[model samples]
Target: MRLTRRGLLIGAGAGGGLLLAFRLVPRHYAGALVAGEGERIFDSFIRLARNGDVSIAVPFCEMGQGVTTLAAQIVAVEMGADWKRVGVEPAPVSPVYGDAVLAARWAPLWMPLAPSLADSPEGTLARLHAEREPFQITAEGTALAAFEAPLREAAAAVRAVLSMAAADQWGVGWETLEARDHAIFNGRQRLGFARLTQMAARFDPPDPPVLRPEPAREKPGSFPDGARPAYPRLDLPAKVDGSFVFAGDVRLPDMVFAAIAHGPQGASVLSSYDKAAAADVKGLVGVVHARRWLAAAGTTWHAADKALKAMDPRFKAAGRIADSVALETRIDTGLRKGAGQRVAAEGDPDALLAKPSLSARYDVEPALHAPLETATCTARLEEGQLEIWLATQAPDLARRAAARAAGVRLRDTVVYPLHAGGSFDARLDVRVASQAAAIAKTLNRPVQLMWSRWQESLAGYPRTPVSAQLSAAMSPDKQRLLGWRTRMALPASAIEWGTRLLDETSAQAAQDAAHGKADPLACEGALPLYAIPEKAVDHVPLDLPLPTARMRGGALGYTAFMVESFVDECAHFAGAEPLSFRVAMLSGQPRLVACLQGVARLAMWGGGADASGQGIACQRMDLAAPEGLRSGFIAVVATARQEEGAIRVDRLSAYADIGRIVNVELARQQIEGGLLFGLAQAIGGSTAYAAGLPQSARLSQLGLPLLAHCPKVDVAFADSGEQPFDPGELGMVATAPAIANALFSATGVRLRRLPLLSEGF
Candidate 1:
């Protein structure tokens, strides 16, 4: 039976209570790993071979984030395996690898009625949904928080059993044995894991497992300049040598290349195509027509693309066509006249905001994901079974979509997850899987479907466009912020994306369900982290004609830009320094305060005075973990100036407090990469729509920063004893506002919109 929210509610009512319904829910366990000869499987996360090699199963997609290496390092550290012998494999879909943390955090998307009941990883509903749907999604930087403890426990169990095996032969107690460097040691005697794997499989691990004193942690300052990581990325050598495989790199026997053309966003029905023109194209195999798209299969991708172009498929509009002017008008109307639903509130913001001391308005256009690799999927259908290969954040959901599209049972569908060139949350969309499945089923052979650049732009959902008005009520002196309120206008984007992800519904259906609803996810991070007495956030949902999806920074991307830029303006209005103003308000958050101070010193902050071109911004992100809330703090000091009629960022210095450090090198890489991504978003990454199609169809048209345009970036992490917080998004959320504030200092003109200077200066 399919699990729907309505079905769940009905079951709960019929069973008298949610507790009884949960008890009656069927539980699923991870299937056994396919082990090779002389290999022993330890739970769902670890496999030990007779050659002393330890293979860690990484459930997260490796979209150039080093997740595979990070996961393998965690297991290697806990199991005391040799780093050189450690390897990683893409984990199979299973309930044991489900991401309960992400499920809990996104509880509102699935269980909108009572999300609080499942607001934690350990919550009954969260666990049940995660396991049943097998929600092993890889977005939101929740990898470590969800899988760290489980990976450690699995490794530790393997270590314990191996030691027990060695102890049996050494005639010593297992407690006296130490496992390290791929061997079990008892004082001077040593036994390699290869010699004991068969015997260890016979012994049962200690109840609860004997975990190490500290779960995998990297020493601060371990990898300084010119120093190599203790556990280097295992995928690096292969990636560098061109042996690493991505979704687009997959090749199968008797595979035909297919190129697809999707209808424009609003006009999604195929009306006509020139079959004779396509038939004349060399190497053209056949054409497959779907409800919304047309595909041409050929021996080579180039030929298929040529055939698709020759066919000249046309689509008729079935709904209101999306255009830039209409989108802006809708947002403006919502912010100006529509009734807003209060999404977040504290104290009495209405009373204070009645007479605001300062106010600002901001706008953000739809930003594209623009990953290096476009959507590519290879599928084969044979004898009622369908197998697909793709790079997806949500593998199980993609498999289900493929199964349904191919008219096969979900159990008969097999998914082989591949590395992504880059996703930026784009892989969360599983439409390519269904498209490939349909094409392969029609061709009755293996087919590799690739979306062209234009098709990707036409079909891909960009980040939601938003308009917001922020107001601040200050003290009598206008130095201290007293109350804050933000009214944002946007579509219920999160719910729309969730419906497509969870329910596998059409975009229009999802938009229909989410129309005119208050979306807390859309307004996330609008509430300031500062010590304000009264604060509130309101969401005015616009019924937009276009669909939207999640990007790298999520809502925090725009919310931070608005909040930090507004704070900078307030600081200036009060004749205060930008850094000092933020520090004064951040009394409760010592970590963020430290980061602000540290970044200021790193950038040699000049108080963001006129023509100084130095500006400061900070942000805090709190994520729920097993051990309470995990918070990540970041501060960026940007030095930017107007050069040759364009914005040129000179340097960006950042300080981050991401709690405990797992892998210092990888952490630093993530921060640096996020900064570059933010720089891209600040400069371009966005596009305008005309006649239901994006004006910018190619990467070059998006105005992404070139290598020469990239500024010098310096990153530092605070030495905190807090739980590990993923550092993937901190720099991204903080960079844009910093740059915007710096530009204001440089040119003495405040740019309020994202992709700063979208409105001509």
Candidate 2:
């Protein structure tokens, strides 16, 4: 498959790591809750200061997930300046700067992971941040505030300080001076900020600077303000030209190459003794095995491999699994101890599932990030401190891990991110970085460790393999929903033991009892989404040992398939058109209903099912709790039957109501990319794993929708003109399900899985 989808404006931390341990960290984590230790360092973070330059002092690094772009977009939108007028760079950690408050926002909804913000009430932006609740921002969120807040604050402060200084010079009240664009005007003269910044910077620390807030908060116009231009991304020029700097692209003085050459046949670590064999490679540095990892050192990659081959005879495979089904059982059991975990219970789910119910099971296999680039992190000790140079997704996480590895304080480790080849959900994955940092520190030198393709594939964790089960009860009317019970599997990396939605202690028991049995992801859509009064959703999750992480796409894809397929099942029994039935059930769902109706209008839903193929799907992503950024999104796809048994996507359309849009074009692009990937997945999946490894190890084998496969896709945005919405991630939600629905018309198969492939009808 030739895929056409792209993600956020990350410097994607690293995508190639499964092959070479190149990185692309996930800037966006769907289900993982955010947690940070220690006291709040910064009362309020002012990471980016405007002086025609934008600097983001992030704890998280970009392995290649486009976080820099998101951060830049946020700051730029906050400042209400032209994207070109501002610049972006990472903020290094300091005693008074890192903000854990954002993690509250980061802690999650399902879009974030569920947090304890149930008691938190929404308030003004100031009060929201003043308290330690996570600060929320979408690319659009930052842009909206850019015009509304900070620029206004900065401007007023500048004006007030200039007015005070001018008053001292002129022997008048400070109010006597008025302000305009970048200028302080008094009855006698006017001074520009360029001229005043110098004077203001020199003011004594004791000088009380009375900053003024904009008088009319509801109004948008600032002094000499006009609307920001909505156009193509300013950074697109560099992206188009390949001049963009990514983490993998970063280079520092005296960087050495190292590969963590360890892992069993299918990704488990084995024993090895190749010290003598690797001794003769030119430019070859010595090899070391720490934590069972085989490290080959050299100036060039070729020399390292020679050394690695020399050491191969002494290797032994350990903890290897021969089959997917057997590993699947162990993983599912290990991931499901979360049932004992506490989550908000709207009703008694067990008592509800106690009645007779229809049920299904699902199992999602381990998938790789399979990015074009592999994992690569460069670490060096400089002046008694360690510095990291690479593309990392979660720079903050990497920084913390690096600090731990180096036995240094958080402030001592500096991680610089470069652009990334691509990122899925693992950009925030810090294991690869942590391993490299640990190795480098053990050697106490500057080393650029890059994972070989096999190491990248097997050594790193796979998208957490998931298992799910659902059972639901039908009411007498056959239309009303009675209850729902679901069981899922999770990996250790995703949830800490005893946390809500996570239970580590019972995972072993869960998997030990699950081998040779059905799994849940395979039946994700087992429950209907329609409103079922008194309905309760219960999940029994499994925990696994082979190290799993969220393959968000897999969860999403599987969930959609099960739900949609089940909806068809429900519809078939009800003897109603699926579209009409869905619409009827969603009567009061305004945003969703509107989006659904809009997509139908765009896709031209029909009189006959087989004549014109159509599919519909929607996603609702919660932004922040107090902010209340809940919004609905929907899309519909129109597919034409293959004329002569060839794969062809005739037309695709979508309807999205993300509340408000930041950059319309970027939003559209995001949605379009989502649709392409969604449709592709509905076809089968971007990559396939076997014996715990990705078959599509390189881009060549990876299936993607290229230009030839591009459909005539169009999108319509419904503003409802709402506030506090996350347009960034929601852009891609509607495309796949809608396309799958459309394809159902073409081929009577309700796609129950992803990557609707060529061979499959």
Candidate 3:
């Protein structure tokens, strides 16, 4: 029974009876944990040592998101382990650690046809596909939703076995014993884990172990203002002391450093280079050339970079070059002339919006990820086996790509995951792994590839540029919205990204397959938060020369700006206060209403009148979780003023309701970091393309906000007691609109484009 993608698709289209029957069969995990001497393994998540030390395996990548600490905290609380003895390590790639939640959320990418059949983690199709592919990629904030339950269950099973071992000694029922403080007790009898681990390994854990009444949760006021975290981040000490290991920090015996140069946007063929110039540099090993890139290796990275620069490699453009003017023209033409594909709708929006009362256009330029660390990977191919050290969000995909590049079997590839300085969803791309593997195979030695800042700008994909027109039909009084429509023009960014990620296709091939296709992921958050009777969201796909990928905030990063800014304009047109106008329409969402009112009170409740220099905006995100849809709500109030011919944001006040708080300090830090990241996007992080290259190649040229220029940020969370939601992207989605609206109040001018000053305000 050979299975292929084409056969599966054909079966799915032919009534899907075969696939349905296959899904009905129960599936089991077949992977086992590798244990060391004097250590006992519990499933695939926990390893207990004779020294009373516990090492928990985290499947998600830790790119400064506090995921390692959060995951360990759950296990610690459930198993009653001492926090001081708990540590975290990266989990091995196995079926047991597959992320079913992420697979279900991304069903459209893998199972494009009839995605509804596998749109849940529990669905057999979703679980089986995830396990088969071992899809444990760490994007979309699904870490907690996917792993929290299993981690708790694993810890509970360990506790049950240890309790049983202790009960055997005390001659009592295991249920009468409790496991806490690294010890199992029955009445006055106590046995430490160091003594019970060997005995516990001999007993079988009970089926369906009993879980605690409640999972780990921090109280609302657990950590007050200027207080230390209850459980400090386990990685903080090493990171602060310059001992944390990133991809670039990995070293191997007799390793050579390599630097690469990629062709321009429209170029693929490497035409020529000055080999003589590189030969003059001392310690230069050799030069390797690929179809689209050239690499030079040396004893030191500096020598390799210097030799590469001296060689002056050049490439020939194979097709049309990417230009900013041409990209903008395509967007404008598509918005006006291209036919739209309806992706979401509630009622007859076309009829209700025949005569729109108000319509406004918004535009956003392509933005960069600009993490502190560039793309870095180390690879060594020896004796038909490939070993790679990389910091990637998708480990299995990267290993597969690297194996193919080295011309080895997938089973022979070993990937060692490392920490990233910062990703912002940039590590999802695995091109560097393949490039490193190729270079190492060519050189027949260990090689570490590092992309220079200039090369990163020339090769990295930016967030898609978008142009949209929002139309609204209001009542006779012009105070209530009756109909709403959003017509957005952009490339099929989501499809392009998915093809490259899931299919391992080139950027050009992905773009070709995605051209003219309507992407629902690209139109996410276009739905209005307010209760409008009629609404429609339309997508106008455009074929562009430049490629695009996902960024930190995803689609809502831009859609929120358009919707919230337009809502502010409508409020002014109705001659009503901004906060009050929003509250009136938010009758159905009590959570959002509470956030808005709370933010108003936090920021002194000053109406956004003329010269008030105050602006308000709100956003709602519902992420797919195992139990159901988990939601996160946020509202931002910004104060801005013009000082010395510069826009100065004085303060930003935000209030959020993200259900139960797990780690209070970590949640607060995530919100603050998101606010700063959004501020950077609002000010800069964009570039203009000319002659198939970006005009801004250096970080200094991107006009990022300085620390001294950063605004005062205040964040507060609500005690909603709902399911916990990740607060990473909530603060970012609303920051741009709040600042733009603030600038509008400060000066009697509205900036309809991102970066506020792109049109030279």
Best first by lDDT, ranked:
1, 3, 2
Q: TM-scores of all models?
A: 0.96, 0.74, 0.96
**What's the best-to-worst order under TM-score?**
1, 3, 2
Over 444-491, each residue of candidate 1 has an lDDT whose tens digit, in order, gives 989999998888888999999999999999899988999999999999
lDDT against true structure, model 3 = 0.86
Which lDDT values do the candidates have, in the order given? 0.87, 0.50, 0.86
Worst 10 residues of 2 by lDDT: 1-10
- What ranges in model 3 sit over 4 Å off? 1-32
The runs of at least 3 residues in candidate 1 whose Cα sits more than 4 Å from the true structure, single-residue gaps closed, are: 1-32
Q: Which candidate is the best by lDDT?
A: 1
**Clashing pairs in model 1, backbone N/Cα/C closer than 3 A:** none
Q: Write the per-residue lDDT of candidate 2 for residues 1-761, one digit (tens) a residue.
A: 00001211111122211111001222222211111221111111222222322243333343332334544454444333345544444444322121222333333321222244432323333233322222222121222322223223333333454455656666777666665443457765765434543344333221222334322221111211123434334456787998876655656677667766754434345455747666667888667676456777788867877787777734443444334556566655654544423222345556666863566554554556655577778888766687887665445556777777777887677777655565555454555666667767776667877777666665544555555555566666766446655554444333421121111122223334332233323223334446654443334444334544444343454556555555554554555676777777676777877877787787776732664665556655443433444454655555645556545677777777766554555555656666765655544344444554555555445555567878887777775556634354454444555665666666776544444453355
